[model samples]
Structure formats: structure tokens, C-alpha cells
Target: MTTNRTVQTAADAALWLAVHRGWHVLPLNYGTKTPLRGCADCRAENTDHTPQTCPCLARGDGALCHGVWAATTDASVISRWAQRWHTSVWAVHLGASGLLAVDLDTRPGPPPRHPLNGLPWPADEPPPVDGLDTYATLAALSGGTVGDTFTTDTPSGGLHLVHEAEPGRWKGSHGKVRDGDDTVRTGLGWQIDIKAYGGYVVLPGSTSKAGLYRRSSTTTTPLWRPDWLADALARTGHDRTATPAKATSAPAPVATGGRSGPRRYAVGALRSACTELAVMEPNSGRNRKLFRSTTRLAGMVAAGWIDRTEVETALAAAAGHAGLPAGEIRYALTSGFNRPLPVPDIRSAA
Candidate 1:
């Protein structure tokens, strides 16, 4: 993988890949916007959630890079985006940055906020020049009254919107802290920047959006990959596949949702899975707490784990996996405690 290039970020490249692959995902708000917490001073006008995580902290910039990651089944989409940007797997980073900048500029609210009160293209008027490059478009926006202008974001989180003309020469990371206790392990990140936008038969002649670019991380080395990122990427479809370049004697873990470990085999796995019934439970926290007591699961009542009414409350208070049904239990273990997971019989247990 080649490295060393201009304005690159992990998130930018990932999202860009999705866009190129004909996939578009939700974007997260970073550095504090509205509705969303950490993004306090988002566009500050029409604060919205875009799907980005701050990567600045990883850059040792003492901050996070606020951007989003999109989803897709096409593994090659990311690669293709990176290639278009003349970099590695980093188009997502570029795409996100470009979008965030646009988002910040266009946050919904009445004017006169003094910061980012103007629009890149007037609501009534249209883009002065069609197909402007990312830089040119930013320059126009930052040019005052002609384009978009982001003025004031609370400095507390480091969410100062940079102009396309004045690219901050940014040397730091995001302004937000991570959401989990477990450290995120990263092997390599594809850094990207919004270089330009192009090719649009449908993009209105009045609509002017530029493309983005990204490069592999060469400025600084990425940390923590062997344990967490390796699994997260494959499991989440971030890397698509980690096929080995050379055959090794050691076996690789199968990408199955869950596995059967030695010395631990439960009966009724198929029956539990086939008939397992789960419900959606929403939550927000540093760590995800399973809410079994609060909601009654299909097998919870039959298994005698708890009363139907007590399901929601029990699940909310649930800590670790002990004994739920095989399917429910495994599903929970695999995907955010989807529902109660336990084997049918415990020989003589509650």
C-alpha cells in the first residue's frame, strides 16, 4: 500500500467508498452538534447526525477526526474509490470531510448566527460555476456572501469548521472521546481528503458538488490492530475480506456469526435458533447494557427465566451472559444482546 499524501482521514475514505459503490449510509455528528451530544457546536444551525467518528485522537493530534463510515456489500467499492483519489482505502475519509463541511455550512436554522450563517449556494440563486473542484467550491463558500461561511462553534470540543480555502493545515484529530470501554484496535487506516467532485449526468446544472480524495496514513503510524480492528473490520464488512497472501499452517477463524468452542457444547441450538424470537431495544451508553427484564422474549416465559411482564426490567438489569436459550443467548452474545440467549436445559437450574 502506498502512503504519504495530502489531506487524508480514515472516515472520509470509508464513506467515499460507499458513495462510489452506489451505497449511502447515515452520517454521524461530531464535535458537538444538536440532538447528538458530543457534537455540541455542530453546524449550530440545522444540527444533524451524519455517521462519523473522530479519528484525530488516533493521529496524536490530541483530537478526533469527525466523519462517518458507510456500509456496502461490495468490497471492491472502497478499493475503487481509493484508486480514484490516487490513494489507498481512504476515499471514505475525504467524502465525509467534504460532506461534513457542507453539513456545517448548511446546518438548518435562521440566519444571523454570525458563524456559518451563509449558504454555499444561495437558496434562491444557484452555484456560480458548475462542477467546481473541492478547493474552488470551498473558496467560493469561504469567500463570504458568495459561498458558505462557518463562523462560531464552541471551542470546548475543538469543532472549529475550517474553510476550503484555509484548510487549517490541520495537524490534530477529533474533539470527541470514544464511546466504549474496550480499546479500538486498528491495523491500517486509509486516509482521504475531498479533492474534487466530478461526473454527474443527473447532478443539476445548478448543483455544484466536488469529489474528495484520500491516501494511506504516512504522516503517523496507526495503533492497535491485531486484536480488535482485525475482527471488527471483517465482522462489520469494513475490510470485506482479509484473505491471506500466503498459505499458513495455522488456521484462521471462520467468519461465522458465533462458534462452538471445545469443551462447551449446548444442545437444542438449532431448535432454539429456528424458533427464537427477539425484539428491538434501543439504548445509549458508554457500554451497552442488555435489557432482558424490561422486555419479554419468546422463550423467556417458557424457559422460566423470568415472568413475561418482568422481561424488560430483567433485561435492562442484565449484566453478563449466564443462561438464556441457545438461540436467544447466542444472538444476544453476537449482536448486542439481541434477546435472551440460553440453552434449553440446565440439568437442574433456575
Candidate 2:
């Protein structure tokens, strides 16, 4: 396994790992939500582009804002979503233009011809099923990295190893650019209601070649949009540790914790998964979306959009460490779904 120090080049390895594990790498715009959902006036304005001002609110009288940054990385969000939904992140396709985390472990076959797609592997070299193993896989893949790995615990009784990255100036989502349109959730709006930004853009074969900020991006800080080489370099934040291996575990079960229906598992399952995937507690807008997505996925999984096998794996992977069981999970999902069920005394299973 690669350490955080090499995250700068582990993109390829990350992609390979993701593909093998079953995550669909997609590249949708992260903050493309526009107020266009309903209120035309709510649509984000291009007046200044960046979040410095709220274009979403034509006659705004407050600080400029767009969608809130996602509390978790693309990997964690999808990972949790799959577990709750009884599906696998691998089942979906991830797309992005700059998730560079490839490494020697992740090999490329050929040069990329499309600006949006990733480079191809050598003709003789087929894409690895988690196959590509090289020294530079970190940046080669789209996995983010910092300097090194560290163990951290959350309020929820979950242990995890995560990747950290050099604090390269993270330009807030379309904060400076007045693209007029932003975020996929609201569409053509500013303030993408930062609170609603649920997911991150993950393109499997994309490129970071394009500068970080564009008319489409939410980056606004001088650090993110440095005016000069020094400014850019100076603004770059360092996340020395990237790709820390999470100790993926589950929360301990409580008495009388099981659900009472066929689907009561949704609440516990969602809770367990959330405990494992979350780096920070679900507090701010970004975390709120994570929590919501976790619930949505659990309900979706029970509804059958997810395969049983995938659902089990995701839940186990995230919560396995804590040794949480199906009964507890059942309770969590049941509560999360809060739907009617015929199965009574299910919670008694204990």
C-alpha cells in the first residue's frame, strides 16, 4: 500500500483500486448547481463569477456564496452511499478531469487523446483490475493526497486511515468566477445553497492538465487563482499526507437497538456507514449533504436499486472495524426510512 508521502503521484493507483473495488469514476461539475431549479431570480449571476458576491440572489444583501463544499471526498461519499443503498460505488461510473492520484501501482497504457479522459495504458499493458502497480500511481489516479498518514477517531466509534494532501490552495467552489451558472443540484444558480452540495465530481479518465480554476470552477482565492508563479506557489496549501489507509470499523451496538421491520436495518446501516466514511462529524452544510445522501442510499438500497452483495460489502467495509452487526444496521436503516413494515419484534433479535 502507498503512504501519504507519495500521494502526489498516486492518481493511477487510486483509479485502479477504485475500479477493482467497483466505483464508477464520474466527472460531473462539482458546484454547477444553479437557482434555475425554479426561481429564475435565484439563478447564480456571473457578475463577479467567484463567491465574493451572490449572483444566485439578484438583489442580494449578504456575503457572496455558492454551494457548500462537500464534507467528504468523492471516494468517501460514494463509498457510504453504496453501503446505505445496498449497492457499490463501483457499480456507478466516476468521471472527473483532475483527480490525479495515479502511481506506479497504477499504470497507463497510452497517452490520453481526449482532454477529458485519462491516458490509455500501453497496448501490451491492459488496464489493471486494481492492476496498475507502479511508483507513481498516486498522482496518476484521481485520488487526493497530502504528506503522510495518521490515525484519527470520530465521535461515533469508528477508526480509519485516510489520505491527506498538500494544502494546495483549495479554491472554494466557483467563488470568484461569474459563470452565471453553477452547481448541478440547483442548476444556473449561485449559493448552490452550499448546504445542498452532496457529491464530488469523479471522472475516471480525466485530466488535471487544465488549470484548477476555470470559468466553470468555483475557485476564487488568490491562492487558488494566483496572479503569478510566486502568488500561485505561495497560495498552494500542503496536504503532506494523502491516501491514509483508514482502519474501517463499525460502532458498538446498543441494547434494544435492532429495528422492528423488514427494513429497520436502514437506520443502523446508514449510521454505521456514516461513522466509517466521515472524516468530520456531519456539522456544516457539506456534512449535512453526506448525512442526507447516506440516508437516501440506504433507502434506495432497500428499494433494490443496489445489489445485496454490494450493499453488504459497503456496510461491512466501513463499519466492520467496530464490529457492528446486521441487527443494529437494520435498526438504523429502519429509522432512517421510517416506513411501515409488517415484521414485528424484529428489534428483539438483539
Q: TM-score winner among the candidates? A: 1
For residues 1-350, what per-residue lDDT tens digits would candidate 1 score against the true structure? 33333213433433443455332222222212111122333332443533342233233221112322332324454344334433322212323233212111122222221111011122333322211221233334333221223212221211122223212221221111134322211111111021211100101011111222212122221122223212222321123223323212222211222233311222222222222212221112211223222222434444653344333323322322222223223333333323344434544432
Ten residues in a row with the worst lDDT in model 1?
199-208
Cα shift from native, residue 331, model 2 (Å): 56
- For 118-211, candidate 2 gives per-residue lDDT tens digits of 1222334433322112112312332322223222221122211122212332221211112342211211111110011122332222223221
Model 1's TM-score against the true structure: 0.19
Q: State residue 112's C-alpha deviation in candidate 2, in Å.
A: 6.9
Q: Show model 1 residue runs off by greater than 4 Å.
A: 1-219, 224-226, 242-331, 334-350
lDDT of 2 at 225: 16
Alpha carbon lDDT of each predicted model: 0.26, 0.28
| Candidate 1: residue 216 lDDT (0-100) | 18
